[model samples]
Target: MPSSRSAPVARVSQETCNPAVCAPIAEDDKRALVDAVETFIFDCDGVIWKGDSLIEGVPETIAMLRDMGKRLIFVTNNSTKSRAGYLKKFLDLGLEITADEVFSSSFAAAAYLDSIDFPRDKKVYVVGETGILGASSSSHWPPYDRELDGVGIQHLGGESDGDKKVTLASGQLMEHDPDVAAVIVGFDRNVNYYKIQYATLCIRENPGCKFIATNMDAVTHLTDAQEWAGNGSMVGAIKGSTKREPFVVGKPAPFMLDYIANKFGIKKNQICMVGDRLDTDIMFGIDGGLRTLLVLSGVTSETELQSESNSIHPDHYTSKLADLLTVKK
Candidate 1:
């Protein structure tokens, strides 16, 4: 297995903007910026909306861009919802978006599997919700019990009590199934000891089993609060247990851009990624060779951009996506 440390980091051009100082999107530059890009990739959560409410002026701005014949793509690192689920939110927010226009880390994960020709006969042991596997709600493991820590079904070749039995929620003693050929980790709100244990076992016990994660977002920006336990938190646990890293298929990794470019036949230089987060959204654009625009309406703040420790930067920054409204094509 390849070492995670050896994984290649995406390279940007030497002219890439300095991480410590981002240029403000001046009024004069807005028009040029708009004209230079053929497609706009938006980060949904903090840029277009916060929590359940749509961000102010997003609807009009999107419509205006669409009327201008510019392609629009919504890409999000949040794997909690599937693409179909996300489309419902867009419509509910009064945005006229189709299923193809929306892309989430969940869809990227599936696309990655398809690209690699993942075997149809093998099942994936998902440590997440329906977003990752598109399984029915009932197919998910029951709400995990905290008290079940360290209690796990034995792996193949592992010694167990002579009874060769493991008790389940239904009070039935069963043996472990070894059919799982991959372990997919994503955002699971009901995450507990069992899910982690099972995922770890699948990767460690199953030979040549793939390890995939939707995204490694450390925090999710929510209305009134920031949730620190994102999918990265869950993936970290599995990594620590198995000492094997997952092939993260979301932003900053290039899989999402690869999918969009292949499907739409859009050139990377003609795309602009607009989002609030520096790590996922902005970095994704930079990594993919697309122009990047940072908006202050989301996770990243102007103050944070000035920090010397900040390593990723967008080509331009604005107070909000509404700023684009001032730019005429």
Candidate 2:
């Protein structure tokens, strides 16, 4: 419950709170908007920087908010990076943030397994990057582990499984390990027939094997302003072959929201979620009962926000996260 503001959240929040639809934050409301919340949870890719290029004034704005004694948390659906990996990126971007402040879908995947009391003796077949394995645990990954901590789930597959091939030579059938109790799917740039086929076998053949997805984001950004296939596309392949849906653990799931809220002891009404995507980012905030701000700097466009068919609406709309730079002590 950290705050520099004297009062609580305003009676009027986002456009969704009003009888009418969403509206842009006026020049005068900038200070009021920032003052209303105790914590700010941000979505990384689209809202912070698209690919390598940093959004103008983001670092300054982040520093400004920190100076005001506000709590800041960065959350992302990209499973390619871990908490340690994201911390390095934030520091490189000139933002004074720590790994404890950043949570990614990769971490979420591990967290989800812990929440459900996943058997320590069992193994998770990962179909994403090393981030899901975390740092201390990454090098130790094998097809299965005899023992593991709750957060450090025993996992394999990931980059290790990316290049492995399966050959059904001379009437032989593909085989899979029964210890693989769960298949965690994230964004794997090297997703090949081998990984998909292996994942399908684990989920479909292995009894009680769980299917988990980091996030079902339709598309993601890897390069400057360019969109590429998201983890959802990789997930879809397994879904098609296994005929099973995955338990998602990223944005729009609200698992991370609950984590930070309880850990910080902040109420949902005392927080505001800012992001560029309506589906995952905005929807995530909405589901968790936090105020939502939609920024037009990433996957979402102004046209998409104003689209007549769109049902998801954030509490406020802004050009970018840097817009809050207008607010001061």
Candidate lDDT values, in order = 0.73, 0.79
Where model 2 places Cα greater than 4 Å from the true spot, the runs are 1-8, 11-22, 136-150
Q: lDDT per residue, candidate 1, 34-121, as tens digits?
A: 7777999999988999888888899989989998999999998877666767777888889998877988887777777777877766
For residue 175, what is the lDDT in candidate 1?
36
lDDT (10s digit) by residue, model 2, range 1-329: 11322146454443442324556777556777777778999998878887876888898889899989889999998888777667767777777886678878887778778878898889999888877876444423322111123365677788887778777789887778889999999999999998998899999888999999999988888777568888989999999999898988898997888888888899888788999888898888878878778889887777777777787877788899888887665
Judge candidate 1 against the unseen true structure and give its global Cα lDDT, from 0 to 1: 0.73
Per-residue error at 2 for model 1, in Å?
27
lDDT of 1 at 263: 96
Model 1 residue 83 CA deviation (Å) reads 1.0
TM-score list, all predictions: 0.82, 0.89
